[model samples]
Target: MSMIEFKLNGKPVAFDGNPLKRLLDVIRDDFGITGTKEGCGEGECGACSVLKDGKLVTSCIIPVGAVGGCEIITIEGLRDTPQGKCLVESFAEGGAVQCGFCIPGMVMAAEALLMNNPHPTEADIRLAISGNICRCTGYDLIVESILLASKKGEGLW
Candidate 1:
């Protein structure tokens, strides 16, 4: 077992558990952050994505020890941010959200993309969300949402 300390949302927290325990399990079971979904145990799916020090990563594949002293931002934390609100609105307005299982990870990935490339092309948007798969929208609406969001200034987010 190992002791891991990190910022969850904006608050500091610590846990003692197996070093290899998935961050998803620690968040969902120990920390009670259910917004970060577990679609796949492996890292291929983005359903378990979260921001680790402001970069998108599959929480399921991240061992608890790996997150020691890191700041972890889950979907629950995103909902409280201005960027998150903008993305959520754009997602709903553009019909990008469906079934809702993949929306959080999609939104997180989109936010990361927008942060890096404020004016991304359609192909860039596609590539940004490539790690995330949606069984519901076929990606057209999702792409549209990212494009629409890019026009907004980073300060707005």
Candidate 2:
């Protein structure tokens, strides 16, 4: 086991695990941050999305060793941010969630997108969240909520 040091949710954290262990497992199992889901173990799906140094990343495929010295942001980290709450509220109001499995990752992806481009067009929103698949919602409402949030200026970083 190797000791890894990083910042999670804006706080310092350390964990002992295999160097190649997935960051998603470390966050969910070791740190009790279950918001980062394990959908496809590969990087194809954004189910394990997290922000590494303010950029959207798939935690499931990232090794713990690669995360050291970086700041990490999970869905839970957004509770204290206006952007996070706004998007969540909009998602609910827009009926963007169903089954709820993909909500966390989708939200994180949306946050990253909105932070970079608060006024993203529909195509931008679609491309940004394309990695995340929601088997339940068919993505119509999801896109709608993001577009709505963008127009409202909720995604400003």
Candidate 3:
């Protein structure tokens, strides 16, 4: 066991356990943050997506040790932010919240994209969320939602 320190949701935190433990497990079990869900533990699915140092990554594929000194932002951390609110409100207003299993990952992916490209094209939005899989919604609404957020949430991202 090792003590790994990192910034989680804008706060500095530490974990003392198996270094090889997945960040998803640490976030959900150790830190009790259940917003980030595990879909395909193999990392093929983006349901466990989180922001690692402001980049979108699958928490399930990342080891706890790898995140030391990095900033990790999960859905719980984002849902309250202005940008997050914009994305979420866009998702809701655009009817992209079907089934809602992959919304968190989708939102995270959108945030990661918007932070870098406040004015992204459809192709950009598609590519940004390509890692995520949403069985419901067909991605049209999600794409439109992101586009809407980009336009409506100007100066926020």
**Top candidate, metric TM-score:** 3
How far off is residue 90 in model 2, in Å?
0.8
Q: Which candidate is the best by lDDT?
A: 3
Candidate 2 CA-lDDT value: 0.89
lDDT of each prediction vs. the true structure? 0.88, 0.89, 0.95
**Model 3 score (lDDT):** 0.95
By TM-score rank, best first, the candidates go 3, 1, 2
lDDT string, candidate 1, 68-113, tens digits: 8899998889877888888888888898877999999999999888
Write candidate 2's Cα lDDT for 1-157 as tens digits.
8889999999999988798988999999889989889999998888899999989999999999999999999999975688888888888888998888899999999999988888888899999999998899878899999887776654365
Q: Which sections of candidate 2 miss by over 4 Å? A: none
lDDT measured at residue 51 in model 2 versus the true structure, 0 to 100? 94
Rank the candidate models, highest lDDT first. Answer: 3, 2, 1
Residue 87's lDDT within candidate 3 is 92
Please provide, for model 3 over 51-133, each residue's C-alpha lDDT reduced to its tens digit, 9 standing for 90 to 100.
Answer: 99999999998999999999999999999999998899999999999888899999999999999999999999999999999
TM-score of 3: 0.98
CA error at residue 26 for candidate 3, angstroms: 0.2
- Report the Cα RMSD per candidate: 1.2, 1.2, 0.7
